[model samples]
Target: MILSPSRGETCDHCLAVTVSIQDAEPWCPHCEWNLDRYEPARRPPEFGWRWIDRRTHRLAYRLTRDQFDALVADGIDRRGPALARVVTIGASLLLLVGVVLVAAFGVWLVVHDFPSLTIPFGLAALGLAVVLRPRFGRLDESAYVLDRDQTPSLFDLVDEVARAIGAPAPDVVAVNDDFNAYATSIGLRRARVLCIGLPLWGALPAQERVALLGHELAHFVNGDVRRLLLTQPAFTMLGTAADLVRPVSTFALPQSALMGWAGELLAEIVQRVLARLLFTVHVVLVAVGLRDAQRAEYLADELAAEAAGSAAAVNLLDTLLIGETMEMVVRRDARAGHGPDQWRRSSEQARTSAGPILPALRQLSLRDQASLFATHPPPGLRARMIQERTAQGPAVALDQARLERIDSELARHYDRTVRNISWGG
Candidate 1:
């Protein structure tokens, strides 16, 4: 992914720069002129399977999106103790019961004096229980956590945004050098954390920052069942179990002719069988979550409009849709040894310069079905929805002075992020 320009060559669309000969053909680093044309061929396999699972995912996406849209169109809002929620609760309970039953069975077998079975079956059962054990999402200790005492202005902004959305303020705020922001609750205590990406934050206008904050914090109160305490663990457990049981490459067998070959073959068969079963269940769980997740996203968008304004929310979606362009700006800056502030300045310049290409990018999003399998709806669709709504002024405004204070508080982290991006961190 080195960015280079050959002699007498420039991007056809942006005329900014072209990729190196070693990189993919006809790809422009600046405007992503022809990137979408090769997306299908370049997409990797899912769930350790090839075309079969990929096709399944596409089908699931279509069905889920169609259903969600139709339901919304009919003014039918399904949330709170719906059938999906019930199934989610039942599924989690069943998984827990299965784990307990397996552990109990293992213990009973060991005490029944079945020595032969004890070593193989009992231990295997106990091991399966261990792997299937429920997971509570844990706090990411590796993240650069912003201390409240040190970054009070930033925390105060977050608190204001949370209040605007009628959600509790996050217990922690962390920063990263990515193109996204997210909110998640960790551990049994459900301590919520708000993670902001410096690249995206720096690129955003102040009001749009409030829009971004509103969208993320709204996840807490938007009936997003995937983020719920009980269903969240259930939604993740099966996929994790499948991953844990997936066999390594069968091609890398032992050198031994007889004993090793036979043992490896048996283990591989068992692992593959278990993996398939777990993956099937995981797909089902994900399918169940999809419709509800899609609904939650649209609702969160509405809340974002309420907190910020319909125009700002729509503007935020437009900014998000240009993620590839922003990425190119960063990549080129990294190679050119641009200073730390270049991220923000270059990003805004790229965005502004590429105005003519923005419409095509939006159409490309719809053409590629880019957000079909994603948690959120397509940016184009979200923006359109926001535009259709009655426009409201910002309920929680971020004035230039306040934004400057917030920026001052995050100055060190921003510098570190820029340095990391420049040095290829």
Candidate 2:
């Protein structure tokens, strides 16, 4: 029998009754569960940028999948290193062009004295810089940064993974309360930082922990981190430009009756036209960048499999589905005034309870239409790629005693973080 979720219905997974139906899919905002699976079968073709992106992504997937399978069959593929160079050069050029455009506009304004053009050009330049600038100030506020002294064992494990992958070690390591892990490059120097979510780490087994690290550290090895830094700015700038030029309500204009209304209407029309143009540019850039991003995900998965066996890598991906469910449990427990220890136990319980449905949940996500703005490919596709290419082997061996010690240390950090965290309603 087929199952479907209705409006105002409670999610079977999270038990939240606030499920909203969109396009016939029941979505739980609190737990992020989509009850209905999205199937893209023989629908009418999309027009414009989406159609172009659909074709581009299909080609990218084919090329990258072949390279990934070949890498698994033999050894590391040269595509990763070659692509890294291309990304770095492309990003540098893009940033350079933004700078030149702003400079040329400034020179033109000064020489020609075009005061009327100054506002738009200035806004565009500011928007470009806003998109391209790297900000790291919030990192300190949101997560605890660990130095070698504070997390020696954890650093040691990270170093081991870096050596295995032949990539540079991250400049800093941080721990947060979330159920996800990510790597980022910061500031003008682009210093690398690896952030591990404490709750997610606590939920994983030792082998799976290694798999998670392998996947994240592989980003550096495959140059995915650098590529993101290069390609993301244009897309960001375009979005920012659109937002900056979007029309404001006429009601907010000066109260001069007819004159004010007419002037506001004219300005609104111009703003909307400019905003649409900027949005179109944003869509094109996003479509182009998505192909690169999805390819990087596949390459990173291959590197992860090489580092931690096929089974462990695949297990890690499966575990991620449970991580979302576990997060909902954590939040629910926290709201009920549960302490840190209880939160940890609740996480474990959620993980166990989710085991049966994890596969189904992942399949649902895979069935969803691949969006032009998504950073990674569908999870089901990733699983298939892993199964096809990854060979079975023992995960990277770490001393059990040291692993236990790191776990204990992180647990303490999690307790402190939970206690100090404030959830303002």
Candidate 3:
């Protein structure tokens, strides 16, 4: 560790240089700064150990003197280890047990034949598909670069924060009229594709844009991006099955209230019976979803702030949370009939326009959830994160006026988006 500059006084007990001699007590923080000392002392048992941050109920880091200094110097990494594999193992074991039980029972059902492990295997395969859909459903493009003229120069901003935290760069750009952005780990390679709503550039300052990028970047650096993607399909399948059979998210399966309880009890018994032969991977995944979500989000936000340097990111985040609630009339009606491309375009516009410092954002809706939530974190949590960091120590940055004017031109286009009442609303 680089030693601090020589200071006021030296310690008598140890050869440590102190930054200050304000208090009466003698404790030199650095190498022997005590001008006069009596009994020489040895270094403490734990030399350069300190707490860095927290991970899901566990203290996540142990910092040495040098590493701690490095973090503060290079800016701290916001992303941390995700306990995904932990959850994965838990789910897998549970499922394995269920598979064994199911396979055993299947054999017992036809003991003379004693050959029906196929049933359990089929269930496991189904679970695999649902669990890994995030990877499986990705576009396999070698890379998707933005059109040069259409490209936004978030490169500088994204690079600064990403380098600070050692996160991967976003590969996809959604340069449209939305305020939304998402980080997804896709394909076998787990490449991250970040989609940003174009209009936000005008509304948010350059640093604010960086902060948003940082938050999204945190998803990649943090395990949440991966966890959410990989576990999502399983989570949805198991939860939906539970809701349909036992009523976890929606109303109980069709039955009288009393009968529904009986139905749920029957379902539980059946589930347990099947579990003996089936895998609990989906069940455990379904159970731990929300807890993981909240924890991972915090780490991402903190990291984003560190990268962007202060609460400046918080301002734009706040704008999005507040302004996003409003719905405006726009011409996207031309691209109608509830398709993803249209929907993605609409969602992105609202998110970008709502930025606090945004010059403008086109009309886009933020309320659609049926297809969107599966891939992205909500904006509310991001807004709160910006607020929290600002309460502690806000990051600040300086930008050129010419660069800002470029953002302004982008803003002007949103205001002129045409309406198409001809299509269904």
Best lDDT among the predictions, by candidate number: 1
Error of 2 at 189 (Å): 0.3
Residue pairs with colliding backbones in model 2 are none
Q: For model 2, where is the 10-residue window of minimal lDDT? A: 35-44
Give the total clashing residue pairs for model 2. 0
Count clashes in each candidate, considering only residues at least 3 apart in sequence or on different chains.
0, 0, 40
What is the C-alpha lDDT profile of model 3 across 41-100, one tens digit per residue?
211212123221111112111111222234334543334433544574455455445545
Answer with 2 or 3, whichever has the higher TM-score. 2
Q: In candidate 2, what are the lDDT values of residues 1-425, reduced to their tens digit? A: 12234555886678876332224355564454553333234223444465564664455444444544554566545255455345444654675577667756655654565566576666665555555453332254567888787778889888887777677899889988777898877765768888987767765666677878888887876655334555545546667768878986635755668787787889889999999998887666665555556667777776677667788788777766455576666666655655445665776676666665555555555435355555776675576678876376744765568778786667668666555443621
Best by TM-score: 1
User: Better model by TM-score, 1 or 2?
Assistant: 1
Superposed Cα deviation of residue 7, candidate 3 (Å): 60
Residue 411 alpha-carbon offset, candidate 1, angstroms:
1.3
Weakest ten-residue segment in model 3 by summed lDDT:
362-371
Residue 329 shift from truth in candidate 1, angstroms: 2.1
- Candidate 1 C-alpha lDDT tens digits along 93-187: 78778778999998777777666556677778888888777666876654688999888888888898888878888888898878788898888
Which residue segments of model 3 deviate by more than 4 Å? Answer: 1-85, 92-135, 139-145, 148-152, 199-202, 225-234, 240-284, 325-425
Which window of ten consecutive residues has the lowest lDDT sum in model 1?
Answer: 363-372
* Pairwise lDDT winner, candidates 2 and 3: 2
